[model samples]
Target: MIKGINKMLTKSKLEFLVGLGIIILPLQGLAAAAPTEMTKDDWLGKLKAVAPSVICQGFFEDASLKKRMEELKIDNDKCISLIPASFDKCQTQYYSGLPATMNKDSAAKWGHTIGECIGTDFATKYLVSNPQASTSSSSDQTTSSSTPSSTSPSTPSTSPSTPSTSPSTPSTSPSSPISSSTPATSSDSQSTDISRDQWLAQLKTLAPAMICQGFFGDPSLKKKLEDRSIDNTKCVNLIPASFEKCQNELYSNLPTTLNSDSANTWGHKIGECIGTDFAKKYLLPTATPATSTSSQ
Candidate 1:
């Protein structure tokens, strides 16, 4: 009886150990099958969830992404499971905490980005918000889009009995005027864009306005101005907040020479160098002693 009881107890203990081992063994290997983990897409579905968007934009231009873009090409679209990840990056970067005023400098950058991937309308609207967008051709902001209709209707046929040969008709009128109008308008527009870029660069730099004008206003200046007949009043009405900030930024770039009784002295020197009225009009109002920045 004693032997039978000991044998039964031993077997029961062994069975319990075996069962515990079975449970504990799998727990120790929690990551052994991690290779089968679902991807960002598999978990989030077709559109990436918030996590992926942040990873794309926050990590865009990261060296790894650039390498991935080049090496994978079309395949790159699928490599990370986020299709066309670069665009995800762009949207994130563009809308992220942006400055309200799209000044000449800001507009150029946004325009370049827009040109590469987005529709033109957003880019033009962004530029219009900047004071520097005034290079004579912002008027070209006009554009319209068309989408294919979901349903199509059959075309009606003309009467079959219509005479095959009609009476002699005068030759189609020349469209030379239409053709002529486009080239001049196109050339003028191009000129204005070129000018806007030049002006943006100069205003962004330490270059004095006269020096900048000289550089941009050459025969090429026409090309730099974005619009020739910019309506300042209209511009203010369009984007008053940005316009106000951009105007402040424009003056911010002016020379430190404006900070002195020496402004009068500096103006004389600048007039001698550039032979222009810029210094007189630009510097006189803002001139003050060097230490007076806070008082203003």
Candidate 2:
């Protein structure tokens, strides 16, 4: 009886030890799987290093887009300096915090982890809205969206045929002086409209306003024009907020150099730029600055 009792106790002890080991092993594995978070300073430093690649990736050739990226970069640096970094609840936070507009391609480009995207978005917002946290929090904000749609509908037709009597024909008549002059006037108007459209299209693609004021001194615009002429164009109303900022800068800084007409022309050029193929590339949401492994 004594031997049986001792054997039972040993077996139970071995089972308990095995169970405890199983539980602890998984916990240790989890700890290893979890990633460490970075401090704001280290994260921002990494971002600063990677920023040129991020900003220049899509539309660097366009001066207006480059200027906007530069403006954002300034705010990015300031925000990273001021804001503390934290990403503990990455999975839970990312699911809840992701923007409605964020897509898979964007995530692949910007996300270290899904949660990092949320952290980035928050950082950008804080940086963009609050300047130094000491100055008033009245931030300059702008929003834009586009929806292009075209549809064609066909109408059903019904007709009835009836017998008719022969009718007398009218005598031949010469062209009237009014009709003769009308063709010339119409031709002149059409020519003027075509010329205006071509000019506006070229101006829009080139963004002459940003280019003209030392923003982008690409001689390529003139070269492109000489190589291939623009004939057809679509008008656009939306322009980047940076254009307004640039205009204000020009007016305030160089009052004698840039007039209202010049500003207006630049404004139109910006509008035209927004209508091009590159607009979609440039308009994509900017990804957040990357986080550092050692930041935590």
Candidate 3:
């Protein structure tokens, strides 16, 4: 009876071990299958591949725009060709401030923001009402070719008037603005005339106020800052200094005139730079020390 009980006990222990192994094998497989974290370079690589096609599709998918392009004889290929240049311009603005490493969720959000920037840049440059004139000119050419020779002289006269009117329209519009906003134009001209040193000094004085307002006023970002224990005072004190670094990096190719649109663009860029510096300095998770294990 003792021998039989020993055999049964040994068999039960073997079955328990086998069952535990079966459960653990899948868990191990699952752990191995888990995704590795992506670095900023990896995300940027993926963005370059994806952003152009996405932006082009958005423009081409618009029924009215597509129809207009068809009428204009503008090849969709032309739009595709412009994407590389647009993406290059926008990539630095959006991606330069991102952390080196990101988890899946954060990487996705960053990608979405960059995609929007690229789309805006591409649309601003390529999608214009001016291209419609090409279609009109082509129609004129076909009409002249089909008409009698006596009528051709009239077409030339009408074409000359069209070009003359085009130049006048732009001249009158600009003159009206210049006449109405004489003071504003003078101030703009004065700003253009300032030396670079004076401009930098002015920017430095303005940086603190702009940075503080942008940082604390943003609802989503404010929560993130609060979580990091970064309040208004700390932000004002610490972040304004980052503007100098950002200026050195981004302002080397500054436009001659810093108009309202350009100012807004640079403001966003500098703000991003400051935010990036702050994150690198403070927001990264601290590494925990590993516990020592004694060998048996």
Off by over 4 Å in 3: 1-36, 71-73, 132-296
Deviation from native of the Cα of residue 141 in model 3, angstroms: 30
Residue-level lDDT of model 2, residues 65-175, one tens digit each, is 234335445343332222222222222344344344322233222233322232233223332223243223212111000101000000000000000000110100011
Residue 28 accuracy (lDDT) in model 1 = 14
TM-score of 1: 0.15
Rank ordering of all candidates by TM-score, starting from the highest = 3, 2, 1
Each model's backbone clash number: 17, 3, 0
Q: Worst 10-residue stretch by lDDT in candidate 2?
A: 154-163
- TM agreement with the true structure for every prediction: 0.15, 0.17, 0.32
Residue 9's lDDT in candidate 2: 25
Question: lDDT per residue, candidate 3, 1-296, as tens digits?
Answer: 33332233222121111111111111111112113455655444433333333333333443434554565465544444445554455555655687787554454344434443443333333332245544444444334323222111101100111112222322112122222212222232223232234334445543444444444544555575577666766655664556667678877766654433344355445545555554444443441111111010
Model 1: how large is the Cα RMSD against the reference?
Answer: 33.1
Worst 10 residues of 3 by lDDT: 150-159
